[model samples]
Target: MASPQPVDIPSSILIIGSGVFGLATVYSLCKNPLFKDTRITLVDRQPFPTPDGSSIDSSRIVRADYASPPYARLATLAQTHWRTTFAPSYYHETGLCITASGPEQKYVPSSLANVQALGTDRVEVLTSSDDIRRICGLEGGAPGSGNTGYVNWSSGWADAEGSMRWLRGEVEKLKRVEFVTATVSQLLIDHTTQTVSGARIKNNSSTSTTTLTADLTILAAGAWTPSLLDLRGIATATGQVLVYLPISATEQTALQSHPTLLNLSTGLFMIPPSNRLLKVARHGHGYTNPTTIPHPESPSGDAITVSLPYTHIDNPSQSVPLEGQRSTRTFLEQIHPSLATRPFAKSRICWYTDTRSGDFLISYHPQYKGLFVATGGAGHAFKFLPVIGDSIVECVLGRTPEDFKGKWEWPAERVPEESWEGDGSRGGPVGMVLSEEIAKTTSKL
Candidate 1:
């Protein structure tokens, strides 16, 4: 497709966030001839490799198996990179077994059709619970983990942290982007002109606030994006649950090659064991932490309530609440009965910047001339680590993929998050408040 009418290239660009979107954009900017002369600056509150950031996790799914054909097609293209040049060592193609029970079963066949449409011939359809158990190595699990599903040997996972580290090294080798470590307090907005010039960043160690001015500013702060803007109903941060169980080498070797088992009905998934650690996470309507803060775009200090991320940084001793733990345990009993009673080595609350439709917000700010947003991961942006930056750059230059033109654009009107018709890929309970779940940590589900 032809590119859109090009916007004037800015002399300087500043990106806030070091996750895949931000870092990959840096890599793409360095490689793009149009941006070769643009002075780029990447600023993050934490040092390289954010300990609590969702992208810096042990694993992330890398698959083209999606109910949405556009995503499935794009993911298939990205999977080519994962299989070849982009962090190939970190990529593993053991397989992915996507399943569902009850109402979530509606998503399974559609996803299967998408993969088949992509010409993937390594798919094994499971028509019954026994088939699911057999393909996923869940014979030892409970009676029925799922009723229907498929195992795509072509689909796989990536070592998330390793891939990010490699990409960071690749970006550093280019030496085009000046990396800054500081916390962004607020945006430097030109209230009169309705433009964003840069941001007010504070250095934690020096205890001083400084201004970072750029001709163009891209906000790709993932779950923290809404905290810097008045995105109340437009987008919200939803914390998902994760539990890590340490297994013996003997057990790990036995299950290391098994396909990742994910049940959309319960939003529970278990990737294959690696490094003696097995992670169980949920891909669902996660828990929201509603916080009230000063409206970011208002000059007169207006308070707005939005769902923002609250992580271990907010509470050092925090762990996944009892409700999340119990839910995972119940799934474990169904999938891996032997490990149902096993103590978890650790737990975490990974947050997703969920938009109303689960689509990424990656376009110029409607109200601000010099600002652009590239966040809203919604729990599944990591797989695009290899090429999302180039796509973001395309949008920045007034050009977007034909398939994602409307999908990635900023909405013209605001809508309540609750009213969103999602991509039909999510499961689990809804309207779960984080505080409420945490409060029930003392009680059993």
Candidate 2:
């Protein structure tokens, strides 16, 4: 079968999920004169700021720090918006210290080389644990957590919720979009034509469903995208762990200006504190929650299993597994020994729409017409919140940036999950089953 060409813009576009990608695209479309006559509609399960959405976090690292040149360059471009008018108050130039102590240490230097090549003089190479301690402000000196690392003053972190709220407000100010708050049950596919018209959505849990048809449909649902498709090895959802602890005013002041510390070897990272809350999290391959459900496009209503996101929205009381909690605690003890004994205030499972190679799965569905996919964040799309929409719009017009043409394009075929080699940035545990690990829970908080 011949591939579908993004030759012309659709008269109406239906976007599911109002997260970063959705809002960004809305903003870009409103600004672009080419889409002045286009009717744009956005539908999501929740209102503007999704509670369990990955983009609705307190803080997200904004850095041109990646092992891949394409992403590194793209991130550098996005940072320009971050430093300027794109919610400038929410972005902090606290810097980032990326370290490693295990075989995954290779990612540290490789990322360093890319960023340094970008011609930023703010790069400082850390050859010892003491070097990390000095720059990252780890008074306890974490010799065990990370041995070698580098600090990039050009890097920083952002208040994710604030930024998203700001972006949503900006998009609404244009008044060019119709935002509908509804839960999309399935894509409205015309099987005979092999075209995805739009989506069948309902309010919360109402049995009655309504269809919103359009000339084009873009699925930017983030981690929940796999649950709407038969993405096995192509793209899957993984749940990452996050543990937050309260800090005193003085403690917050001391750690507020410190650079974010990340250990590539273990995937443990600590971003600077905000609102007197300190967060310890991991960026590694997260736990997979395999679920069997009727395939969205199955005419016969056959069931298929896929790794889907099970967030607080699904189970409000669900917490991170014991293994994750223990790992995060160990990371905190290594970085800030004083904070290790402090009781954790809260913990949550953050989901990521991860791809096999860690490259974003952004492309028109090869099998379905009028359907474009824009997900597979791989735990990193938050930094590009500013400029990613323009890029996605370009891809929608069949003009993918030269740098991301192959990187963001959909895979020609699906390979077995175990045989996949990620973008070479992930580290720590692999093949963790969420249920098995949750069953081993032995912690109160």
lDDT top scorer? 2
Q: Give the least accurate 10-residue stretch of model 1, judged by summed lDDT.
A: 1-10
TM-score, model 2 to reference: 0.97
lDDT of 2 by residue, 168-265 (tens): 98998999999998988899888999889999988776778898899889999998997777778788888999999999999999999989998888
What TM-score fits each model?
0.97, 0.97
State each model's C-alpha RMSD to the native. 2.2, 1.6
- Per residue, candidate 1 scores C-alpha lDDT tens digits across 305-325 of 888888998899899988889
In candidate 2, which residue ranges exceed 4 Å CA deviation?
1-6, 102-104, 442-445
Candidate 1's clash total is: 0
lDDT at residue 165 of model 2 (Cα atoms): 95
Alpha-carbon shift of residue 129 in model 1 (angstroms): 1.2
lDDT of each: 0.87, 0.88
